[model samples]
Target chain A: MKRIVLLVAAVFAATMPAASAAGPVDITFLHAMPGPLGQALKQIVDGFNATQQEVRVRAEFAGNYDQLLQKTMAQLAAGQRPDLAQLEVSLVPRLAAGGHLLPLNPLLNMGNWQDFWPVFRRQATLASIGGTVWSIPFNNSDPVLYYNRSMFDEARIATPPATWDALLEAARGLTQPGRVTGLGLILSDIWILEGTIWSAGGEVLSDDGQHLLLDSPEALRAVDYWARAVREGTARVYPDIQSWQADFAAGRVAMGFGSIVSWRFLQPQIRFPLSVARMPYISRPAVPVGGANLAIFKDIAADQRQATWQFVEWLTEPAQQARWAGLTGYLPVRRSATTNPQYAPLLNLPATPSLKVGIDQLPFARPRPTAPGYVQVQVEMRNMLEQILLQGADPRGVVRQTVERANRILAEEATR
Target chain B: MRKARPVQDTLVLLVTAVFAAPLVWMVLTAVKSQADVYMGPLWPRSVHLENFRLAWETAPFGRYFLNSLVVASVTTASVLLTSILAAYAFARLRFAGRDWLFLLALGTLMVPGEVLLVPNFVTVKRLGWLDTYAALVVPFAASAFGIFVLRQTFRKLPVELEEAMFVDGASPWTVLWRLYVPVTLTSAAAAAIFVFLGAWNALVWPLVVTGSTAMRTVQVGLASLIYDQGYNLPVLMAAATLVALPVLLVYFAFQRLVVEAALQSGLKS
Candidate 1:
C-alpha cells in the first residue's frame, strides 16, 4: 500500500510543475483570437508584463467567439474561472444576464472610459444590461464597402454611393449585361443585416428588449431594397464568406461589403485598384460595430480583480491600442489611438487601403442587438433572408412571420 | 462474382470521385500560390511548394507532432490492454452477473462522448492532470467500442480450445495471450486504428484540457492557422494536408489485414 502511494505521488510530481516561489500575482486572461492574431495579442500582454512587477498576466487563445463562449461556460460550471474574458458584442448580453459579470462602472475612471469612440461607448452601455457598462470595447471593427475602382470609372461614376438607393443606381450602371456582378450580397451575416435595418431606421428589438420589432415597415424597406437589386440581376449571393471573397478578388463582382479588418486578408489577393468606403446607409449613416470586448467576471478572486482591471486599463491605453491595431488590423477602441505615433505606419502603409475610414465610421456604428434572446433569434433571421433573397418571397409577410416565430423562440428562452 | 456493367462502373467511379474531390482540392491548393488559389485555373500555372514550408514555420509543428504521436500511441496501447483483459474476463471467466455486466458495459456505447465532456473535464482538473499528458491519455485509456470489437472477436473463437487447455493443466493467461492473440492479430489491429485516429484528430477536449504550447497537438496547430474572419486558403490547406498524411499512411498500411480479418472471420455470430 505504501509503495502504491509513493508511485502515485511520483506520477503526479512528474506531470505537474513545482509550485513557484511567491512573487507577483498571476491572473489568467481568456481571449478569442487565434493564429497570427493571437500572436499579436501576445505582444500586448507581454508589453504589460514588462512594464510592471505587481501583476503577471498569462493569456490563452480560446478559439473564436463561439468556441471561447463555450469554454468559458464550461469553466464557469467547473468553478475554474479565468480572471478576465473577451466576449463578442452580441454575446455580452448573455454573459450579463448570467449575473457573473462585475459591472465595470466602478473600476473605470471617467476620462479613460470617455476616451473610447462614442459608438463603442454606446455599445458598451447597452440598455439590456441595465445601462451599466458590463464590458469595455477591445478589438473594435466596422463593416465597410470595398469596391473595384476601374468598374466604377468605366460606369462613369465619379464617387461610390453614399446611400442604399444610390448604391442601386450605381449598380445599374456598373453591372455589365453578362459579365460583371454589381454587388456580392451577404445576407447570412447577421452583422450586415443589423447595420441595414438600423440604417433604415428600424429596430431589431424594442427598447425594453422584450419584443421583436423586425416586422416594422422600415425593416421591410431594407429587405426590399436588396431584393430589388438581386431581381435586376445586378447582384449575386454567395453561400459563404470565403466564396464571396474569392469571387470578389477574381473581379466577378464590382463591389462587396466586409469588416475593415478583413482588408488584411482581401488586399493580399486583389490584383486591381481597390477602394474603401463606409457602409452606405438608407436613411442616415449607421453601421454595426464588429469585434469583442473585455470584462471582469464577478467570480474572480477579490484580490485578483484589481490586477485584472489594471491589465484591461493598460490594454485600452492609446499606445497599446495603437500598437495592437497596427499589428492585427483591428480598429483601435480609443479615438486617440488613431493619431498616435505608433499608428503612423498603418496610415502610410504603401498603397494602404483607407486606414482612416474605419476610424471615421466609428461615430456611426451600432452593436448588434444586445438582447440575450437574440442569439437564438438569429436562426429565424437567416431563414427570413433565404426566403426573401433566394425564394423571392414578399418581405412584408415573411418579415411578420419571422417576428412571430422569433418571439416564440425568445419567449421560450426567457422562461428557461 | 458478377461482371461489372458500364452504368454500374460509372456510378461507382462517380461516387469515388465525390469522396476524392475535397482531398484532390486540398493537395492542389497546398501547392498553389495565394493568388493562384483565387483566380488561376483548376491546375496551378506554377507550383509554389513553399506553402508547406510556411505552414511548418507558422507554429512549432515539430513539438506538436511529437506530442500527438506520443499521446496517440500511448492511448492506443492502454486501450488495447484494458480491452483485451475486459473481453477475456467476460468471455471465459465464470462470475456473478458477468453477462449483466457485459451488457451494461455495452450500454455505455449509447451515450455520446460530447455529453460527458464537462464531467470529464471537471474530473481531470480535480485530479491535477490539466496541461499534462495524463490528461490527454488517461480519460480515453479505455473505450467501450474497443472492448466490444475485441469481445466479439474473442467469442468467435472455439471455446472448446480454452476448456481443453484448462483440463491439460494450462493457465488461462497462457491460453489467452499465447493462443488467442496470435490468431486475432488483424482484429486487434482494426481496433488499434480506430483508437489511434480518435486520439490523433481530437480538437475540443484536447484544446480545453491542455493550455501550454509545449503540450499542444498537431490539430491545435492547424486550428491556430485559421485566425479571425479570414484565413489564407493555401496555407490552411497546406497545414491540413500535412496533418492528414499520417492517418492516410496508417490506413493504407493496415488495409489488407483488416479487410481479410473482417471477411475470413465470420462477422456475424
Candidate 2:
C-alpha cells in the first residue's frame, strides 16, 4: 500500500510541473455578443490558446443583454460565476456596486493603458462605480440609419435624410400600402425610443441619476413627436424589435434604425443594395452607444484573474481588435486600431462600407444610466412605450404613471 | 354519443393536425437545402440529407450523446433509490412530525425551480463539482415530485405485504427490496422517466456551471450552434432533430410501460 501510494504521488508530482509549465489556469468568459461577434471571440480564444502554454481562456455565449444578466445572477448565486463576462456598458454600475466585479483600474495601469482611445477611456471611466473601473469597453457601437437603396431609388429619393423633417418627408414618399412602410420603429425597445428622444434634445432621467425627468416638457414633446410618425399616415410602428428587423429585411419597410453591429447579420442576407447614413437628428445630433464591455468577476483565484486579464488585454490590442471589428461590424474601441492599415481595406469594401458610419459617431456616443433594478424598471418603461405606440394608451397619463413608477424603483434601489 | 361524430372527429383532427404541423415542418426542414429553406413554404422542394451529416460533424455530438445518456441514467437510478426510501418511510413508518415533514416535502413543489437555482449552484460550486457529471445529476436526484408520487404509490400498496415481510423476520430494507419495490415499480418508472427528461434537457444550471464543451449536454450544444452560426435554418433543424432523436426513441421503445405506469400512479389515490 505504501509503495502504491508513493508511485501515485510520484506520478502526480511529475505531471504537476508540466501542467504549470503549460500555464494551466482555465478561465470561463461569458459574452452577450453572438453570431459573427461570437466567431470573432472564438478566433481570439484560439489565438490565445495557441500562443500560451499556461493560461487557457474559454468563451461561452451567454445570450443577449437581458439573458446575460439573468444567467450571471444565477451563476453568482450558485457560486459558479464565470471568470469574465461581457456586460452592457449601462449595467456596469449595479454589478460593480454589488461587489460582484473586480475594478480594472489597477490592472489597467499595470498593463500599460496608453494605447486606448480617449473616447473609450472617458466612457469606461464614467461607467465605473465610485471612481472604480469595473469594466473595460469592447464591441462599442452606435445606431445608424440603414436604408434599402433600391427602395430609396424606387421612391425617387436621391439621398438619405439628414434631419427629422426630411425623414418624415422621405417616409411619406416611401409608404405604400401592402408593399412597404416608411420607417420601421420598434415601440418595444426603449433604447431606440430614447435614441429618438436624445436626438430631439430630451432627457428620460435627470442628470443626477436620482430623479425622474420623464415629465419634463422636453421629454413630453419628444414622445409626442415620435408618436406623430405612427399617428400620422406616413409610416407604421412595429410592436417589437424583431418585427422591425424582419419587416426591413423583407422589403416591407424602406428604412431601419439598428445598431452598427447589425451589419454582420444584415449584410450577409440582403439581396438589394443597402446603404447607411447617420441617424436623423431633431434638435441636436445624438446617438446612444449600445454594445457590451468585458468585466472580470470578483472572487476568482488570482491566477484565473490574471488569465482573464491577459485575454481581455490581448483582445483590446490593435491588430486583434481591428480584426474583430471587421468580422463583427462592431466599431473598434482603440483609435489606432480603427486607423490601422490592416482595417482600411476592409472598411473600404463596398458591401459593408456602411460600418464606418457608426465608427464616425463614437465621439458623440454616450451610454444609458446604469443602476440597480434597472431591468425591472426598463421592462415597465418598455411596456409603457409599447402601450402608447401600439395599444394607443393615453400618452400623457401613461408617461406620468411610468415616471412615478420608475422613480419608485430608483428610490428602492437607492435604499439597497 | 355518436350522433354528431363526423364533425367532432373532423374538428379533433384539425386541432391535432395544427399542433403536429410544427413537428412535421421541423423534420422536412432538417433535410432541406438552404435554397428550399429560403423559399419558405410548408414543404421542401427536394431533400438535402447532407445537412444532418454536416451538423453532426460540426461539433462533438457523439460525446454529447454519450454524456447525456450516462447523466440521465445515473440521475434516474439515484432518484429512484432516494425517493423510494423516503417515500416508504413517509407512507408506513411512524416518526415525530411525520405528517408535517411530508407536507414540507410536498410544499417545495409550490416554489419555482428558478428560485432554487442560485443556492443549488452555490452548493455545487463550494463542493468543487463544476464541470463534473456528478454535479449535474446528483443534487437533482432528491426530487419533491418523486417523493410525493412514490409515497402515494407506497400507501396504495396492501399493508399485508409489509406485515407478512415483518412476520418472516425481514427488515424494512428487505421488505422494500423484495416486495415493496416490485409492487411500486410502475410508479417509480413514471417518476424516473419524468426526472430523466428534466435532467436530459436541463439548460440553465449546466450552462452556468460548466465551462468546457466536453462537459456540455446536447441542449447547450445545439443552442451554441444556433448562436454561433447565422440562422442557417437547415443546419439548425438538423441539430434539433438530432437532439430530439434519443428522447423520441426512448418514448417509442417504452411507450406501453410509460403509459401504464402513469395511469396507475395517477388513478391509485
Candidate 3:
C-alpha cells in the first residue's frame, strides 16, 4: 500500500511540473453567472483555449451574486483570489475601493479598448480607487418590459406602454376577475426599484455619490406611482422576484419588467407569443445598467495577468460578444455585433420582439453609484420599500425615514 | 377512543398533505411540460419521463453523489465519536473548570457561521486542503450542537450502571465505549442524521472551498446545472427528485429506529 501510494505520488509530482509548464498562464476566472449564460461563458473559455496556446483560462461559476461576493472576500483573505472575477455592478465600488482590483486601463492600454460601446465603458470606468479604472463591462443589460402578446392583443393594449400614464391605464384595463393582472410588481426586489426609480429621473444616491436621495422629488414621485399601482389593484405585489417570473409565465401577469437576459430563459418555456418593450418611462427614458463586469484581482501574478487580459480582450471581441448575446439574452457590449448577420436572426425571434429594448436603453442607462456602502444601502432601501408595499404603510413617510437612514449611513462612510 | 382516533388520523393526514404540498408540486412540475407546469391543472395530464434522464445526464451526478455520500458519512461518523467523547468528559468526568469549558463550547453556537467563514477559509488555505474532501469535512467534525445533545443524554444515563462497570474492572474509556455509546445510540443517531443532512446540502462553503468542478457536491452541481441564460426546469426537477430520493429512502428505512430511539432517550433522560 505504501509503495503504491509512493508510486502515485511520484507520478503526480512528475506530471505537476509539466501541467504547470504547459500553460505558462493558467488563471482562475470566477463568475456568478448561472444557467445557460454560465454554459455560454464556459464555451467562450473553451473557444479561447482552442484558438490560442499561450493561455489556459479556467472558468468557475461561483453560485449567486451575493454569495459570490462573500466567496471572493473569503478567497481574498485566504490569499487565493481569482485572476478575474465577474462582479456585479453594485459590488464593483466595494471591491475596487478596498484596493483588491487591478485597473483595466493598464490592460486596455495594451489593446484597443475603444472597440467597446461608450455606455458600457462609462458603467465600468468610474475610477474605483485613486482614479483607477478597476474593471471593464462584459455582460451589460438593462431591464425591459416582457408581455404576453396574446394577452395584450386580447385586451387591445397595443404598443406595450411607453409612458407612466399609459402603463397605469393599460394595467387597469387588463385587470379582470379570474384573469391576468396588468402588472407584476416585484416589491421585494431592489433591482426593480432601482430601475423604476431611476427612470423617474431619481438617483439612488446623491449627484456627488455621497448621500441617499430617496426623499428627493424624483424618488417620491417614483415611490408614489409604484404604491398607487399596488393599492389601486393594477399590480400584484410578489414577495420575491423569482416567484413573480414563475407566476408571470403562468399568465398570472399581463406585463412585467425584468432583465433582458430573463427573456432568453423565459421565452423558451412560454407557450404563447411574447412581446418586449422599453420599460415604461415616467419623467425620462432611463434604465439602470445591470449584470456584471470582469475584474482582475490584485493578487494575480504578473504573467498570469497578461494571460487573463488576453482572454478578456478576446472574449469581448465583436464576434464573441455577438455570439454570447445570441446564446444569452444579455446585450453585447460591443456595438458592431448588434448589426451582425448572425445576431440579426436571434434578435428577430418571434417571442422576443423588443429584446433590443435593453440595448436600446443603454444610451440612457444610469449605473448604480460606486460608493463603498452601496450594497448595504440598496438592501436597506429594499427592506424599507417592502415594509411600505407589503405591510401597507405610508410610502411617503417610510421613504423619508429610509432616505434619512441611508444618508446617515453614507455620511458615516464619508467620514471614514 | 376508537371514534376519536379516525378524526385524529384525518387531522394528521391533512397536516402532512399541507406540509408536503410544495415538494409534491415540484415533483409534479418536473414531469409536466412547460405550459402544463404553469397553466395546466394541479395534476399533470401526462408525465414526461425524459426530464429525469436529461437532468441526470446534465451534470456529473454520479461523481457528485459519491462525493456527497462519502463526505456526509465521514462527517457524521467523526462528529458522533468526537461529540460522545467530549460530552462524556464534560458530563461524567471530574475536571477543573468543566462548566466554564462547556460554556465556551456553547459560546461558539452564538457566533454566526458567516463571521468565521473568512478565518476558517484562510486556515484551510494555509493547510493546503482546498478542493479536497478534507476541506469540506474537517472544520465541521466537532459540532457544538452534537456535543450539547450528547452531553444532555450522557448526563441522564444512570450512575449505578457506571459504578457497576467500575466494579467490574472496566476503565472509564471502556465504560464510555460499551455503556454510554449503546445507551445514547438514539441521540447519536439523531445527531448523525442532522449532521449528515447538513453536510449533504451545504452550498456556499463547499462552493467556495472546492475549486475544481470535479470535486463539487450535489448542491453546487445542481446550481451549476441552472445556467445563467436559462434553466431546463424539467431536468432541474428530475435531478432534484433523484437527489431527494436517497434522503427519503434513508428516512423511511430508519424512521422506526429513529422514533423509538428518540422516545427512549427522552423518557430515560
After superposing candidate 2 on the true structure, give the runs of residues whose Cα lies further than 4 Å from its correct spot: A1-28, A32-36, A49-56, A60-83, A106-119, A237-239, A267-271, A297-310, A345-351, B1-4, B32-39, B57-59, B157-186, B226-230, B261-269
Candidate 2 local lDDT, A24-71, one digit each (tens): 788888876544456667887898899977778877876567667877
- Give the alpha-carbon lDDT of every model: 0.83, 0.76, 0.80
Best model number under DockQ: 3
Off by over 4 Å in 1: A1-22, A176-179, A339-354, B1-13, B91-94, B265-269
* Of 1 and 2, the candidate ranking higher by lDDT: 1
DockQ-based CAPRI category assigned to the predicted complex of candidate 1: acceptable
Model 2 TM-score is 0.86
- Shift in Å, residue A171, candidate 1: 2.7
Model 1 Cα displacement at A327 (Å)? 1.5
Across residues B210-249, which tens digit of lDDT does each residue of candidate 2 receive? 6666787877667655542135667778988888888878
Q: Per-prediction DockQ, in order? A: 0.43, 0.23, 0.50
> If scored against the real structure, what TM-score would every candidate get?
0.91, 0.86, 0.92
Which number leads on lDDT? 1
Most TM-score-accurate candidate: 3
What does the lDDT read for residue A91 in candidate 3? 82
Flag clash pairs in model 2.
A22-A53, A22-A54, A23-A54, A78-B121, A78-B122
Provide the TM-score of chain B versus the true chain B for each model in turn.
0.92, 0.88, 0.93
